[model samples]
Target: MDINLVLSELQKQNKSVYKNVFNQFYKGMVLYANNFLFDQQTSEDIVQEVFIWLWENAKNIEINTSLKSYLYAMVRNRCLNYLKSIKITDDLNLIDLNSALLLEEDIDNISEDEKAIIYRQILKIVEGFPASMQQIFKLKFVENYKYNEIADELGISVNTVKTQLKRAKLKIGESIPLLLALFLHH
Candidate 1:
């Protein structure tokens, strides 16, 4: 399928072209989203939402990259936003029960762009880890694999998986302050 031609048709609100694009990309998008979200249903929903948005804004949407790249980036940003919302709720629950209501309001007010920046920064840090640690971290977090599953696939012990993940997290934790400082100063 010629993505450019399909995109052209999409901009004209052609259902056949929209269906073709959906058929070609939907499953791949769902799998890509699942890598971040680790939930089949949520991944499908996110991809569906992206397609819906694409259809709604097709006439005004500008694509500087391949359609695949744009779609994947959209999925990644949405997954990060979803994760951040969950994290905020979890943090609020751990901090104070009474403040939960207030935090819920604040959480909804948090900027998605800021979350995407933080997530990208974290990904940069993760990429700088040792190769083995990077693989372990990606398998554990990005791929949402259990320690034992990672160990089995990598032919390593569960303890090794745990130790490597701990090291990776520690490295990320140490670099976060410096990264945030630079980000803020810039």
Candidate 2:
């Protein structure tokens, strides 16, 4: 099938044409995704997801290259993103392990009422952050969200999420010690 014809059908929202494209390219795209993810099921899922996204966004898609290249690039990008999210989860596990003991020691010593007081003060510090930074901070730390998840939910890029988080951490680090020292001393 001609790429231009397929794209033309796509713009017209032709379901049969979309199905034909899916049938033609699905297997190769899955294999391409599996090259990076090493998981057949996940690769298939990603490929299917790409097809869905392509279908949904057909009207807006502008392909300067061949359709094959565009579809392959989408699969490849999705695979890389999957790997990145996995790495982030692993890194978060390591961070959690490193911090658990310190948190446990300090938390064990504090009364529930005092902990509430500390939480309120910490919330105050967080509230003072820039709007976007404060929302990202709460979504990530308090709500236990991943960086990409926060970015997707907030409609920002991953780099922007990381930058905001870095700045938030610095600000929190500057504020938290005084609050902690006041509590930990008593």
Candidate 3:
């Protein structure tokens, strides 16, 4: 299939084309994930996550390169992330109940510079979101506004407020794998 046509269909959010593309890529992606993570089930899960991310960002994602290469890259990155997270857990010595219990308190031991870096990345991504969705997200999350409050302020119905917030959350969830890769590495 022509990648441009597939991408166009993706922009339209066509379910059938999306399914076709996912099915075509699934095996290779899983193999790629498995090479690093060495777990078939987790590799399958990671590939599903990659496809979900692709679906969510289809419109914004540039496909100037081959889709196969893109899928390979995503799987490789996710597997590396899985390995790095395992390394972190090992280094923290959280192999026992006692260490697990102390983990919560140790989080506050994060240095100010680390916190600032994470906060800045979060802000950058949020700011990059579409303007209306950004406003809805800020109102819902930062302002802690109820759906009704958001509806009244925007002069939209409560249902509209709810829908917008849901869409905003979906967008964030779709971006999560990528964000996790970046933040976990940092």
Compose the digit string of candidate 3's lDDT tens values, residues 49-145: 9999999999998876899988889888888788686452223221111232212233344445554553444444556677777777667665567
Q: Which clashing pairs does model 1 show?
A: none
Model 1 over residues 104-144: C-alpha lDDT tens digits? 33333434554455565566666577778977877776566
Instruction: State TM-scores per candidate.
Output: 0.47, 0.47, 0.47
Q: Which sections of candidate 2 miss by over 4 Å?
A: 88-186
Q: Which residue pairs overlap in candidate 2's backbone?
A: none
What does the lDDT read for residue 34 in candidate 3?
Answer: 67
Question: For residues 76-164, what per-residue lDDT tens digits would candidate 2 score against the true structure?
Answer: 89998997875532222222222531233454465666665655555566667877898897678756789899999999999999999
**Candidate 2 residue-pair clash tally:** 0
| lDDT to native, each model | 0.72, 0.75, 0.68
Residue 21, model 1: Cα distance from true site in angstroms: 0.6
Q: How many steric overlaps are in each model, in order?
A: 0, 0, 0
Is candidate 1 or 3 superior in TM-score? 1
